[model samples]
Target: MPVTDVTTDHEALTMTLTAEFAASVDRLWKAFTDPAQLERFWGPPGWPATFPRFDFAVGGRADYYMTSPRGEKAGGSWEFLEIDEPRAFAVLDSFVDAGGAPADGLPTMRVVFAFEPTAAGSKLINTTYFTSAEALEQVVAMGAVEGSTMAFNQLDRVLAGLREYSAGKGTQTEILDDTHVRITRLVEGPRHLVWRAHQEPELMRQWLLGPDGWRMSVCEIDPAVGGRYRYEWEPLEGMPGEKFGFDGETLLWEAPRRAVTTEHMTGTDFPSTLNDLTLDEEDGATLITLVIEYPDKETRDMVLATGMTDGMEASYGRLEGVLERVG
Candidate 1:
């Protein structure tokens, strides 16, 4: 088992677990940051977790449910508080109701995950801070230590398989559910430059154009919470398709890491979709993950039918070129 030590301090109202893994810090960090990898082992042995929504950035939230063998489910939520790439992160963890809100009368704990380089590979110091001794006792009674240890034990298998699983997969899209889709791309570029390509209007204009025949006519961005951004596109001289634009307000903006926005088709009555974008860099390449939540299943199908993924792939192909020149 990876977990080497566990301790509880009643006076300090805290519990800590230390685990060592035969993987680099970056590998371990990606195991936690990537929702697809995280869900693989987040639950105990019998309970498999499904993270329907995971915005892995500061000021974001992750809603997940673990389903038991008997089909019973336990829901939980995490509000990300702090994130330091390849080093540490902290979150407020709580029991959540079906609607994903924190359940009443439930205790919330501040959990910090610290990653460090060790002689063999890497070490993880996971500490959970409870509000009081009573709260700590409540969790202990509920088998927190045993459950957490079981969850941690599964990480090694996941780490062992991740490289082969993700290698050379370029701009892939997965339908998460009826109304949600996740798109991921591993770009050969640094994180900050990738983020700037999305934020800066000049950089955006160079690559956000969907396909060869499309041109970005307008690219206005306000990179702040509650600020608005607008992108308009038109076909090149003799190409087909009408002029179209999209505008949205930023919901969360954590520099060079993550951003959430509400996107709307500029001239349509269709409901807006929530776009959550996150970037994580390991080695020299950055992994870009975008989770889009549509208003409903009908809207999702309609959008996908328009060859959205193909267009995005084309844009990302151009983006790599832009990154090459800028980088």
Candidate 2:
């Protein structure tokens, strides 16, 4: 939601985007420089990214690729041209081959990243200069705008995790059983604030959605036992019947500590599951745990085959950013 605007100037042969993040300049800068952190949120949803080699210095190069759910890979490279730590940087962005070499007959662009302090937090302005207006239009048509937006959203999650770890919290995940999985994180915030993020629709909208170009058009929650809720997501541009949602009923509710819900995926034959969440305070941090249980092993395997675990991890990563803002 902090990604404010994106614009293109045909005459100037440039495209720019401005976004406000609930993080410090240093925290945000690290998200770009840190290879591991960059890889986590560098690609669009359903596609995980990897940075095989990253050298964040003037004249250095970064070789990376994003892998789709079907194992298809799209490679890219960045040639760093400027490095002003914690403030601004510039690079030459280009398409690359599997061996980390620039692809032939592809256009390269100059990208400048400027970070400025703001009253709320920090503002990041990205300006990309292309060789021609046609080049800019080509990239836009290839979903560059949407991909960059999703990448920034992932950066929000990275910043949040960095803040929590800096505050002495640890995050971990475990596969408890064939039909069960649990994720635990030490959130750097109060229990009540964390609970509010789960209950409030406005806060949920900020991080609940998985990727860019997809929005929660409907969010309804009732924080009482037997209360029903529904969240519907609609793509920015898609077919008429492409919309999907989740509808569920709260089985148990206890303020700021625990909640239990049974959720079903709409428009699908997927089996519903009971989600149990617990929060405990320790040393001024909230130790949060979420456990999801499916009906049986076969159903669990079917769900796992759909890549639900990776999606949930991505969503939880974004939740870190939400927590930092609310805290």
Lowest summed lDDT window (length 10), candidate 1: 157-166
- How accurate locally, in lDDT, is each candidate? 0.85, 0.77
Which residue window of length 10 is worst by lDDT in model 2? 162-171
The TM-score values for the models, in the order shown, are 0.58, 0.53
Evaluated against the true structure, the overall lDDT of model 2 is 0.77
Point to the candidate with the largest TM-score: 1
Cα lDDT tens digits for candidate 1, 1-327:
799998999989899999999999999999999887887679765455778899988999999998653346799989999999989999999998887888887799999999999999999999999998989999999899988987897687578663344577767887766877878777878999999998988899999887789889998888777799999999999999999999999887768766778899999987999887867676677778787888899999999998888889889989999999999
Angstrom error at residue 25, model 1? 15
Question: Which lDDT value does model 2 have at 135?
Answer: 88
Would you list the clashing residue pairs of candidate 1? none
Query: Candidate 1: misplaced stretches above 4 Å?
Result: 1-104, 107-164
